[model samples]
Target: MAEICCQEAKSPPATVATASASAAAAAAAVASSVMDRRRRRLEMKRFRLATDLEESAAEYARAGKRQRLQRTASGSPPCPGAAAPAEAETVDPDRCPRYGVSSVCGRRREMEDAVSVRPDFLTGSSSSRSHFFGVFDGHGCSHVATTCQDLMHEAVAEEHEKAAAAAGSGDEEIPWKEVMERSFARLDERAASWATSRSSEEPACRCEQKMPSRCDHVGSTAVVAVVSPTHLVVGNAGDSRAVLSRAGAPVALSVDHKPDRPDELERIQAAGGRVIYWDGARVLGVLAMSRAIGDGYLKPFVTAEPEVTVTERSDADECLILASDGLWDVVTNEMACDVVRACFRSNGPPEPASGEGTSSSGKAVSRAESDKACSDAAMLLAKLALARRSADNVSVVVVDLRRGL
Candidate 1:
């Protein structure tokens, strides 16, 4: 260090010595301050590291506690509820038809998608633990979708109840596919009635969804799957679809109803409506879908009658997927099945089984990990669709068929 301060001195040596000592002292002080600041910054970083570790541990503990405590009545699963979860939904592997659902708002400004799962959709003497899973994609408004999410199951249950009552004498059998179609028809009529009943001048919903009575045809597309002990019945309207993952392959269960389809176009024309080419094919250049719920303005042209398909469950079936068009617009059935199968595999190498005598090539998925697999698969599909630039909201449901999830 070179000294800058020098006091009046008789000799040059003494003056030089004083200046050297003063400069050294100043340099030492500056160095000490710099060292102190660096030390404090390092300490702060360590403190933050500790804080973050503590928070993470606490969250993990809380999650474990919630899993242990959260339960529903016997034979039923719990809802994700108000926590909004922000995480994948899980169910105890002990439950039947191990299924989980997930929905995401993609490039759209708002999330207009709805999903639901009813473990014990119907309960009684027949004792069929039929499960219900559905995805509703809203267009122009989310109200109708939300409404269907809340009421569609009840309509189905009503029909099932009637069938069960009639079969009490053991003379009749409950036909699920027919019930599904009837339920869809009832759902459409219910929505139409509910919409027309609303005040003509009522205010729009929080999402700015128009009242069904006054809108340009606000409606929702629906795809539903009913998991009975013997059958997997699917019903769909609009473009939402359902696919069954079988032996690691994709088997489409419901066909997407598009305006461009021959039958759909013919129906529209028969109803005295035009199928015009606008932003692709559309009915009267208005609704892009040929069938939907609560499109009162386009009624007689756009119907809510869903096409139902029934497939008997077999050991070969792996899982089921019900998703909105937002997913189908970019993702394919094979791709979705592959993603879900991968998720199940990543969960823990599938449920371990002993002995090589069995010919089941694919490992069985455990009920405990099944929920995570389904939820993850759904979320992954939605994210994949978004990454592929899907322009609408996305929703997905995965039901583990083997070992009853």
Candidate 2:
């Protein structure tokens, strides 16, 4: 009887162990199955996201191609939202044709920043077009900047034409560097004449009427960009800047001419001028920038010579941004480019084809949308400067350089 009891108890223990092992194995298998399912779900999510991105990019490309074909076939006018090319100049559809500008006084008592946009400013024999964009920031008064807005493009066009004619053939590349330098020199001379003869010239602004002497000290920073199908030429004379967004990267087209720059400092010192740090580095504790148009009182130290950079256009070129110190002081080049890129991406579809199933207001609707995108980009940058507490006048120009797509 004792032996039988012991055997029975051992049998029960064996059975219990077997059941425990089976349960553990089953639990582990269940857990492994759940993990496998989760992994598959994650992979599926990744695949879907990748597919969506690819589809979106392909759609964008297709849309661009279709729109180009429509425009070519219809021979329609440019989007009404864009600045009209010069009446005498022929518009090249392949060139950069869209741009936006925004300017504001921005926490300052006087508005001194000026922006100029002239599309198709120059036309070559091969029918290539060059668009001109400029941003001028005046220190003592607005007249110098206003003058730049009114006259810089004309001077650039004149100089460019002379250079082209001298080349004898449009097939030959024009020397953009020399052309820009001559144009800037001429502009500076004119500005100097304006300042000296302020009394003879009719009063155009508050400075001339109430503060006539201020005209003598007045100076303006000039940052000009000439965009052609093959090249981009930038001329900078002061603290204002020009930046190109190529492949989503910010490429500074012109370096700011600040008094504290090493080379600028050396040049000023060589000219027997001192750089004083009052508020910021200043030429003789007066002008914040080392070079500018006008400021004849500062003479040899504050030159009108511009630093010109000519960059060959590339497939990756996205857009060009020109802005005064008010925007640069508060916004970084990368940040500005990002904002503009977003604006471009968010732009709606192109205008409907005229002959196809298009409505009467289809072109108008599309034009407004396209125009709003660029203008919004410029306005957004200026507003951001204000939000960041920039103390100077704000001006921004966003030029769309995306070609063919």
Candidate 3:
């Protein structure tokens, strides 16, 4: 009987084995489907980003073409004028003219800081000898900061040419100081227009909706330096600053347009803006500094005119540092100079040396490396501020003139 049973069992396949094989195949199919779905999702994300980038480039092209047409019709050089649209709202790599500009964002928010550096032209022509550098620190949002970064240099270059023509001076004879002043005004106007256009556009993402009027209130602090073969002209609005390091010491070129300053306070009051003092020494009630771009809501109480200063670069002038408040908050001007001096001592590269500085081998950190350091530093500072319970978005930019010069 046992032998008969064994024969029966062997004669047909067991139901359990068949069921297990089918289940295993089903699980594998499901996993494959899931992996395919994930890949498709990632592809869609990349496609959307690419589309947005393309659209931004198209917008810039259209804007540039329009400016060229207007210039031709007016028979004027393409200085930024009333006809030029506001600066572009997005950051595009094609727009970057300089070689090294390190940027980093904070942990709690998107990066709103922008920087650019153009080496002095060496064509042996009059205009080729001038070097230009600038920093824009955005508050409320990044649109204004990014726009200024892209357009400020071009605007300055155009204005310099226009000023030369107005004075019947050749490019070589153009007055750098006058060019800086006029260019700054033009930058403000263009930035304002850009902000307006951005505000008028319909919201496409949650970020836009949350900050519906970001463009309107999203003003930026600008500090620009024009380094010529003979002198340096600096223009400042808001707190972003440009400092000169002469013989390894610090010399401030731009004034901080804080509401607490007597001049700034008076200007704000004259413009119908009140400065709210907190705890006797702190300023809390004012919306912004005495000067800024955008902040249309505070336009009635603030001015867009920038304060300009020009100085001859003496033999003592070794380096210049242009930075946003982020670096200033954590490091003083003296300290910054010392840091750079230390880096020089270590035979580091010409850029500002921080913990991010390079080794003694002389190979400076990569752009990505510096960028990550900056981002990490800003985030760490923000966290520290939070630990101390401070509320404000942090942004920073550092420009080292020794290397570029």
| Candidate 2 per-residue C-alpha lDDT over 249-299 given as tens digits, one digit per residue, 9 for 90 to 100 | 999998888899999999999989999999999999988998899888898
Give the lDDT of residue 291 in candidate 2.
88
Candidate with best lDDT:
2
Question: Residue 29 lDDT in model 1?
Answer: 100
lDDT string, candidate 1, 105-167, tens digits: 877888889998888777655545678899999887788899889989888888878877866
Model 2 global lDDT (CA atoms, 0 to 1): 0.80
C-alpha lDDT of candidate 3 relative to the true structure? 0.60
Ranking by TM-score: 2, 1, 3
Clashes of each: 3, 0, 2
lDDT of 1 at 192: 71
Off by over 4 Å in 3: 1-101, 120-128, 168-177, 198-200, 204-208, 211-214, 278-286, 348-405
Clash list (residue pairs), candidate 3: 86-194, 121-128
TM-score-better candidate, 2 vs 3: 2
Q: lDDT for each of the candidates?
A: 0.74, 0.80, 0.60
* TM-score, cand. 3 vs. native: 0.59
